[model samples]
Target: MRSEKEMMDLVLSLAEQDERIRIVTLEGSRANINIPKKNDLEFMEEVLIDDNMVFDIDNLKGFLNDTSSFGFIAKENNKIIGFAYCYTLLRPDGKTMFYLHSIGMLPNYQDKGYGSKLLSFIKEYSKEIGCSEMFLITDKGNPRACHVYEKLGGKNDYKDEIVYVYDYEKGDK
Candidate 1:
C-alpha cells in the first residue's frame, strides 16, 4: 500500500507532464458530493512521496484533456485513496457512450467498497449526463476487478476476448 503522500505525488506528476491537464481535482467524499470541481484548484492537496503507487500514465493527458472527460475520486481522512478516469464517445444519433478507461484503489482500501463507490458514482453520473451506455475492458486474470464490476451489475459479453496493447512513441505505431 502506498502512503497517502505517495499516491498524491503520483497523480500530480502525471498531471504536470502535459499542459492539457491544468487542474486535477479529488472528489467523492463520504457525503457523495463532488469537490474541487473541474478547473478548480484550491481543493488540491500536496503530499511528500515515500513509496510507489504504480499505474500507466501514458496518454493520460489526452484522456484528461478531452472535452468529454469526467471521473470520480475516493478520499478518506482527507487523503486520496482511489480515482476513476474516463471519457465519452459521441454518436451521430447524439447518444454518448461512456468508456471507463481505468480505476484502482490502494491495497489497504481494496475489498472495502471504496472501489464500488467510485464505480457507482461514475456510473450514475454518466447516465445523468446523457450517456447511452457505460463500459470498460479489463484482463480476465484480474478476478478481483471483474468481481467488483460484476457485483455492480456489469455484464461480460466476450469472456474469452483478448486485448492487445500497442505502445508507439512520437510518431511510431
Candidate 2:
C-alpha cells in the first residue's frame, strides 16, 4: 500500500497532468458535523495500547460509507488535504450534466490554487466528454466555497433551505 503522502502526491500530480477529470465533487455526511466519529486507528493505537478493546463499529461503518461516496482525493505530500465527489444527472432536455457534490481543501492548504487547478481539470474533462455544463450545490453558509464557485464563473440558479445551486457551461472558464 502507498503511504498517505505518496497517495496524496499522486492525486495532485494526476490532477495536474490529466484533463478529463472535470469537476471534482464531494458528498455525504463526511462534511456533516453530526455524522459521528471517524476511526483513527493509528492515533488511537498509539495513544491507548493498554486498553483491552475499544471500538465503535457503527461509527466506523458510517464513516466508511460516507467516504466511499467520494470518488477522488487531492493530496499534498502524501496526505489527503482535499477531495471531490461527483454524481451525474440527466436533464429532461437530453443534456447530461455532472454535479460536483462537494470539494474542500485542508485549512492549511487553502488559497494555494489547488482547488482551482482541480476545477480547471474537471471543466476540461467535461468538455471532452461532450457535457454541456457542470453544476454544484453548496451551503450558503459556507461562503468560502461559494466564493470559489463564483470566481470560477458559476452562476446561481436556485436557493432554498441550506443549499444553493450554481452552474457553468463546460468551457465558461
The candidate that wins on TM-score is 1
The reply for model 2, stretches above 4 Å from the true place, is: 1-70, 77-79, 159-173
TM-score of each: 0.65, 0.50
Using lDDT as the measure, the top candidate is 1
lDDT per residue for candidate 2 within 1-173, as digits (tens), equals 65644433444344344432322332321121111112222322222223322444433234234422223444444344565556556789998787776665666778877677566656655566667788876667788778888888888865543543354643443
Candidate 1 has its poorest 10 consecutive residues by lDDT at 42-51
lDDT of 1 at 104: 73
Candidate 2 differs from the real structure by a C-alpha RMSD in angstroms, to one decimal, of 13.8
Candidate 1 structure quality by residue, lDDT tens digits, 27-107: 444335433332222223311121222333334344455677765555665656766667789889988999998777767
User: Which residue pairs show backbone clashes in model 1?
Assistant: none
